[model samples]
Target: MASERIDLLIIGAGPAGMSAAVEARRHGLEVLVLDEQPSPGGQIYRNIRESDPQRLAILGDDYSAGRRLADEFIASGARYVPGAAVWQVGEQCQVHYLLEGRSVVVQARRLLIATGAFERPMPIPGWTLPGVMSAGAGQILLKSAALLPAGPVVLAGCGPLLYLLAVQYLKAGIQLSALVDTAEHRDILQAWRHIPKALLGWRDLLKGLSLLAKLRLAKLPHYRGARALRIEGAECAEAFCFSSGGKVHRLPTNLVLLHQGVVPNTQISWSLRMRHQWSDAQLCWRADRDQWGETSLAGVFIAGDGGAIGGALAAREQGRLVALAVASQLQRLDGARRDHLAREPQGALARCLAARPLIDALYRPQAENRIPHNEVIVCRCEEVTAGQVRADVRFGCLGPSQAKTFNRCGMGPCQGRLCGLSVTEVIAEQRQVSPSVVGYYRVRPPLKPITLAQLASQSNHDLSPETP
Candidate 1:
């Protein structure tokens, strides 16, 4: 009944986790990868393995590219357990996860967290309405179920994803009512300085431009420099409203998709009480990581969007780098050998990230959108409003942890996954301080919800480590 143990335990099966597993196996390290998804690809390439040819064509090559990585990981001899919901990670490299309605524990010599990123919450008024969801959710439907919005749909917010999803939807014969862009002329101006470095990532720039060109060719109603977004409906979203060029426009639509960008999913790191720094450019908290992706704690490392907002390509390279570092640490590879093995991935990682500053600058979420109005719901789980958070700030709620006590802001089922960034920004705006000063929610486990039966099912022997 002793728990399983391995040389390395990875908690995600995204680009980073998959790539790390393949590389670790090459170095003859015993690796085990546990992912909550039923498949290997993370959000960026979700459901790639089972995707049909037509679905792959509609999703584009970038998504289809994950098939190769997933295949390699499957063949790499590393142990992969799908549908494992990891809830608690112990400081001693012990991980507790639920599988098949039962709790299981595992120990590792090293732990790699590649949980990846999620879309930043867009907390405009009526976002909690039934017909409104993040653009990422829309993409998920398309990728996983081959489903498209059936009614009049409006895509709003900034970032390359908005355009990319629009193009995909267009290719799938779904006509969007309009595309309301929240990026302003000033954002473009701010991004200009990063253009030179971004050129090093010319391929990404060209891909972005291609997506834009397709949108223009489709003659989609594209609104630029939009602000003051509001989704109006009595019980569900009916119309998307925004202001652009000093004029307010409201488009009648049954579905409203909103996105600013993605930020690292650092919930696991936060639960571990690792040091995190606020990212001004990305507008989220990032777990501190070294060049090799090791976190502030030894034997624990993070890579991909979980550590920073690098795209999939960067995440793949980071995964390899982290694996190499782990191998060297485990004495499977000497220092010189590790460095030699890391050269290609390191260069590739740099190239992938060269354009990030420009993208971050260009798609920085508007202050109004991030801070939200007093009436707008910021925490969907607890139905906490910006006004409530602001009032709590006035009543001496200094940080997200305090706000939780005052109004249950981050105490909901999501464990502050959706509302953490918004709550921190709202409190900071209310207190006239930086988000770093306001800080984030003090995260704990169970990282995901668990049932009493699951906990009871774990016998003491299963929870105990085997004696050497």
Candidate 2:
């Protein structure tokens, strides 16, 4: 079959994608949105439509705000296809996705990638253990299934999300064992310079402070400046061990939720061979995108956390900005009209992102956590340890792609999503060079796994001769 064609195609239904879809529809653009989730809200607002009143109360207003965006998106008349896993994107704006066990293709004049961020890997010892998972996963369980850990849970690591989840769990009456904060005092000190500007986004700063206040009210054990984290267990995670304030502490817990912060999900961008730069502030690779979210590649755009580590509000504004840019590019709106339309969202985006410097500085992952111990498992899919990566680097393996040949690190089922940052940092540390110099994995196409049958089923007309 000939590929379904549209004026604009958006991947992901998060705040960015949803907002972009709504704005594009207003400009009389034929927009189609494809998402991997079963629901409209991305991870931030997952299941917002189906969430009960009590659950909404527990999750708080920031999450509930997504409902308005979702409703707007639905009412905007954009075609939305959920549960569509886009595996490959071509340079010509052709997208191949798997839906209901069939591979389908679509081509668009313009494409928007709003697939948001993922938590940075905290590759401490025994991180791959059964009972240890990211704090984001725990939030997902609570959001989607209304499930919490059965026994004592220890939320370890540093970030605003760590305390936010703790407060949410407290509201749900799930008592946490302790919070092992990996952030150092120096982090706050480093962030002090950004405080004046961060105040422009005072509501966020207040929300963070409020979350901490609630945790204090509950009298939860908050271990500050924690370091040298290790999960101890023979089979599953039994205890979390860490050092703080010149003393070692071991907390017996069945569940350990780890998080430092989130980084842009640049898998698709990298796979497309788009230019990327290592962000020293956020400590991750960010795709090079213009003010309106268009990337190094023409006709393709990135919005939300997929382009950078902006929060939900910033992402929503970014989506609107990209929509304006796309509308202008398609001549649906003149450049002057588009600029006039974009003014509000541009201001909003600035306001939303004003506090990021403070947040990034305050929660920067320590070198020890970023560059794990030699024995720690960095690549969980291939069971590649940091020691192996370092040994390979010492043997003259230059970068992540070279390390991939030395050992099957990024050649895993997840395609370096889980291990890319860790490997880059490890090689950079070993070589005494910057992460930008060491570089990230050379991401190729077939971004996600697809069956041979799925490929065979696609019509000849849908296949592209040119590789992305």
Candidate 3:
């Protein structure tokens, strides 16, 4: 019922949002941050302050880095609203959200979205089975609850996260049946061209290599050049099968963990109707933005994986840059002052992203791997199959939006978050055009679901004398 206004409103309190708040507070900006999680740290560094000592050591320094940022943000005196689910972000900077089943509205002079990223679509037969989950989902379980999958877990897919999860499993003394890596020999061969540049991030490369080395030394089963992966079971995932090194192999397992990579969580950005472009390397749509994370909208900005797939280091640096830009725009900081403050963080962001091209090339998923087979489910929310999507395409649906009209591929509760990319790829393949031309869904708010009762309550509250 009460509408609060602030100089700056940031959605998400992850690395980018926290860092931005800290820097912006230094400039004396009245800043507020809204985060959906019960605590700070987002996904990458979830539960840092409360993590068990033994678990912290097992998770390693990459995660530990978040503790400093979180602590600084907490002490920075910025107002933070945790466990608030943002529903609508209007173009004019009107923010509508739900907190504890109560509707809250806030208007701000400027807004920043740092919602971060989610696991890429990795659809295959029987993926909707109960025992099958994304690697990120499994990682969340570990990070939030200190939980690990039961033995004979089959991790099928390839990416840095896959290896990271494997290392965590090892550290937790969890057993794995095998790692079915889809990175083929040709991808590594192609990645060699970028090795010189990749060396700039030698620390990351070494860390990655060390994880693999540990996996090898552990004598854990690993399969390379894996393809045609699918899960099988009547009710839940009972086994996994894939082709590796020209041989078809199947493993009896109850848990099938999958990871391809991550793409920016673009739901809010898309709902805001920001300009977006498809990235060939990461195989996703990225919101168009300037170096300071300003989107096409006048006073709206995006930082972190919400804008693109840069990791935490880039996100933190970018957040600082955005804070400076926002301050400058508000005339709190002069243009020259903004430029001077931005210099170091800009360089840091560049260095952090130097090896991204090589890493992206090395793990770029295969084209077939992206577009699901006809029988495979594309939209889990609607239970829409790839075949259904292709059929819609053949019936003159040229893009995800058009396909959604004929088939409810993106109309479910997820609002196309999980199925948007797959739907685009399928439409493009069927239309014999590029995915870029096929375009993505026209995302609208509410970004997350809310009850009609809440809407009615908001309306009634707005008309009441208590509202200001």
How many clashes in candidate 2? 0
Least accurate 10 contiguous residues by lDDT in model 2: 459-468
lDDT of each: 0.91, 0.91, 0.87
Which lDDT tens digits does candidate 1 get at residues 1-468?
133448889999999999999999999998889999999899998999999999998999999999999999999988888999999999988889999889887888899999999999999988999999889999999989989999899999999989899999999999899999988788989999999999999999999889989999999999998988999999888899989998999899879999999999998899899999998988899999899999999989998999999999999999999999999999999999999989999999999999999999988998889889999999999999999999998889899999999999978899899899999999898888999998899899999899999988863214233232
Candidate 3 lDDT over 1-468, as tens digits, reads 233436788999999999999999999887888999988988898888788888887788898889999999988877888898999989977888888898787878889999999999888888999999999888888878888886789988888999989988988898899999999789989999989888887777888799889999988899988888889999999999989877999899989999899999999888887899999888999999988899999899999988888899999998998899999998899999999999999988887887888889988986767798899999999999999999987787889998888989999999998899999998888889888899999988778888898876563113133211
Compose the digit string of candidate 2's lDDT tens values, residues 1-468: 334447889999999999999999998998889999999999999999999999999999999999999999988878888899999999888888988888888888899999999999899998999999999999999999999888899999989888889999999999889989988778889999999999999988998889888988999999999988999999999999999999999999879999999999998999899999999999999999989899999999999999999899999999999999999999999999999999999999998998999999998888888899899999999999999999999899999999999999989898898999999999998999999999999998788899999987774223233221
Q: Residue 295's C-alpha lDDT in candidate 3?
A: 95
List the pairs of residues colliding in candidate 2.
none
TM-score, prediction 3:
0.96
lDDT of model 3 at residue 463?
18
Better of 2 and 3 by TM-score: 2
Clashes of each: 0, 0, 0
